[model samples]
Target chain A: MTIEGQGAVPGLTARIFAGHAGPIAVVVLAIVVIWYAGAVYMNAPRQMDVFKRANADWGAVDLIEGTWAQDRPILPAPHQILAELKKTIIDQKVTSKRSLVFHTWVTLSSTLLGFATGAVLGIVLAVGIVHVGTLEKSLMPWIISSQTIPILAIAPMVVVVLGAIGLKGLVPKALISTYLCFFPVTIGMVKGLRSPDPLQMDLMSTYSASPWQTFWKLRWPASLPFLFTSLKVAVAISLVGAIVGELPTGAQGGLGARLLAGSYYGQTIQIWSALFTAAALAAAMVVLVGVVERVVVRAMGGRP
Target chain B: MTPSPVQSGPAGSDGDSVVRAHGLTLSFQTADGPVHALSDIDLEIGRGEFVSLIGPSGCGKTTLLRAIADLEQPTGGNLSVNGVPAHEARLARGYGYVFQAPALYPWRTIERNVTLPLEIMGMAAGARREKARDYLELVNLSGFEKKFPWQLSGGMQQRASIARALCFDPDLLLMDEPFGALDEIVRDHLNEQLLQLWAKTQKTVVFVTHSIPEAVFLSTKIVVMSPRPGRIIDVIEADFPRERSLDIRETPEFLEVAHRVREGLRAGHSYDD
Candidate 1:
């Protein structure tokens, strides 16, 4: 019995090239090259403007070197961001308000709170939607449309309304994060809960299992893979929400405040560092979710 | 529409009948129109009897099995299992059903999948594990209890599904093409094992299949069904010895029953729908 087109198990180099480091390295190199070019291009005009004002004889090389070395480049080079990160993150005391670590912690606390809330709410709503048809029809559409209104537009309102209610700081920001991240969890959970095919459903019915038993034994476990995949998406967006929530408050804490503070003071390096910190925070959160997903899905008897 | 008159099954005490469906009918309201899945599916499966429903695609053999298992409700006629309503029988844990596909929860170990019904029925954890192990061993899948379904071959997974169905020890076992997806060699091996399991346990099995040799070789009575209105065409009782093997399929007696089943199938079909 000959089965054609069955590819052999890839050797080490082929496996790496096909799925691991090879494509990643290429894409990262391309992005870095583009970043360097963009940094030089944007910063050159400022550098040239300074040279022109001083009436200095500056060539293209001088302008390039000047732009690259600037303490306040409009768009920081990747290396400049890296250097700024090391200076703020490693050199400064973690307790210092100037430290990126201090700012990141403020934002992350709210992000985690929001993410946990969203996860719980999503699962509950999903269960309801799966079991109760009315919720699926009524709440699902509203949940979907809730995301269409820009978080940036709603952030200030939420913060102000909560402030009016005498609630401040973390709760409002966490609410924003919850607002942003809950949709995917809700949608993904609904999809996951309904993931079982008809035969599984029939099997459950044949067992004379109750709806609750059917859910735990069949539906819930079946939905796990879907839940984890959505959690990855939700966790990253939750970071975005927490940062956005921080923006309207102008609170002297959080990476978003740091970015705003840099913008007001013309400290582009500070702004770039804050941006980089937020990016790193999002990555770390997503990676954490990925690790948890691998553990949970594998423990649930699936190939992770 | 000339389905054979209701033929009585082999004589048995009233208490011996695990499933008794009289004039069972089921229909679905589709976008196109009404589709009849089963009509007047009269069947009485006695205690320890192995009955196979054999027919072509869309012939309602699976439908009849599902109806007996209480997975489908008859829109037009009466259906009973264990001399009670199908749904009531289901609530009483009257039968365990095996589908065409393995349908094992991929997220559960083979043992856990087997223990799910037991768990649902509120059996103690220790008892569930013990029963799961015993059934897994019965299916010749003892060592693989800790493994996931995808880690096993198609045949082994189906066997594990069988073990899962049998673990709860329902009086009746409704199997819908349990080995339909396996290769011929694997199907033959499973058929032999299934017969042995049936003999040892003496559980009444209502099997659905499309294979003539499978029906002839394994069934105490073969119910031939057809598609137009989805009703039974003929019910042929076999007198094959209780102690049987895959080699029995090669004998003249098996061929004679297979020929009658084939003829019944032809008689039930019309050139036009």
Candidate 2:
């Protein structure tokens, strides 16, 4: 029997499109619809209250319109945040502290620095734990317990203590990111480094391969998939760490400072814009990591 | 003490055994109790001999091969390879082993995979590449050198593993059911290739398998073993000429040897129930 969809050209196109892009588009559309509805629902009561105090005769259309375009509503509409984004990210000079691009760069620098440092630290620890039985037994429990303490609880303390030692700005923020990001890397790398099959290990023994050779030839390459998976999580968490670090210090630059400033001034639109920008930034960084993982894994003979 | 002059070994040669084990025993300490993997295993593999160990499940054929390769530690008994203890033999890289699976590193090209042992031994880059090329060609995988392991079929992967095991020019090759996972056609084809490879290389091989015909077809000596203490019960010799083809399996002499091997296996298996 012939496959039903094999030779149907239009059906193939539709199926391919529907397989991925279609679901994403539908989900996005649904989110926007819900968001607009929520914006109207949350903002209308305040607008009606204002109208009642002014003894104004307003219809439902006027109330809905008024609520949607409020200057300081509790929840900003999607278009309002988009307008804010365009103003800060596009209209302003990137060098200006007010520009979101400037803030993003500040946050991004710390994220990359923290991610790099954390990844290196994690891999070194993993290697130690895998190769050294004493380290695995001694350091593993400590490493696991390190993540149990909340990053938020520790972020402020880390900032304050590091500040006392004359460390400020990017280094302190990055250190916080390092703390948040290192756990995943350490955990993932441990699993990855131990991922080689018993038979492969036996083969190495047959060849009289040294621990160093076995590591370089077999364990490292095999662990790459696990390392990359951890890297994605680490990078995203790094961004969060940077943002959180900025909060306690009340830093003069970066997305976290923007969020703080917006909150102090009751600029709901600004807050919403900064929050969305942070989200988009996280998504972009994760995708970037995913791209690198694909390249490395494929080069290592994994299926594309 | 040195091994006694035990001429009763079914496949013993004229004092040139590459692998010699006397009263070898290995047991594992599991949660329940000590499990005897191999008990009182006495084996001697002569130079350039192709020996097959055949047994049912739980048999210590693979363990015996591993013990010879120094991958297992025997609780008792004396075992030697290349006139030295098994550990020393391993440290000298005296043998190459092919596992049940291909075990090729996915990251490396087929040539690089073949050169793994050479690289570990710190061979010169040029020599390693040249040797890889020669062996890949020997395995009929020359053009596929730059390709990865996953790019090949299961049969091709196993052949590449064989090339890897041979590229180091070891005098002994220990194979653990190398073709057990392949389909019947592929297994038959591989068996033929392996026999030809053995004839060409003249390396002593100790192969582990459970297939009766496979043991009969490729082995100069067939070792029939039993499980649950995993002891060898019988050894049968089939002294076919080196250049003989697969057609020999149909001959009366071949069938007679096969029949004997089957009988030995049956005799050993009777104790299982």
Question: Which one wins on lDDT?
Answer: 2
True contacts kept of each: 0.79, 0.86
Off by over 4 Å in 2: A1-19, B1-15, B271-273
Interface RMSD of 2: 0.9
Q: Candidate 1: where are CA atoms >4 Å away? A: A1-30, B1-5, B12-15
Candidate 2 at residue A222, lDDT? 86
Model 2 compared with the native: what TM-score? 0.94
What is the fnat of model 1 with respect to the true interface contacts?
0.79
lDDT of model 2, residue B76: 98
Q: For each candidate, what is the lDDT?
A: 0.87, 0.89
Q: What is the lDDT of residue B208 in candidate 2?
A: 96
Tens digits of per-residue lDDT, candidate 2, B143-241, equal 998899989999999999999999989999999999999999999988988888888988888999999888888888888888888998887777788
Question: Which 10-residue window of candidate 2 chain B scores lowest in summed lDDT?
Answer: B1-10
Clashing pairs in 2: none
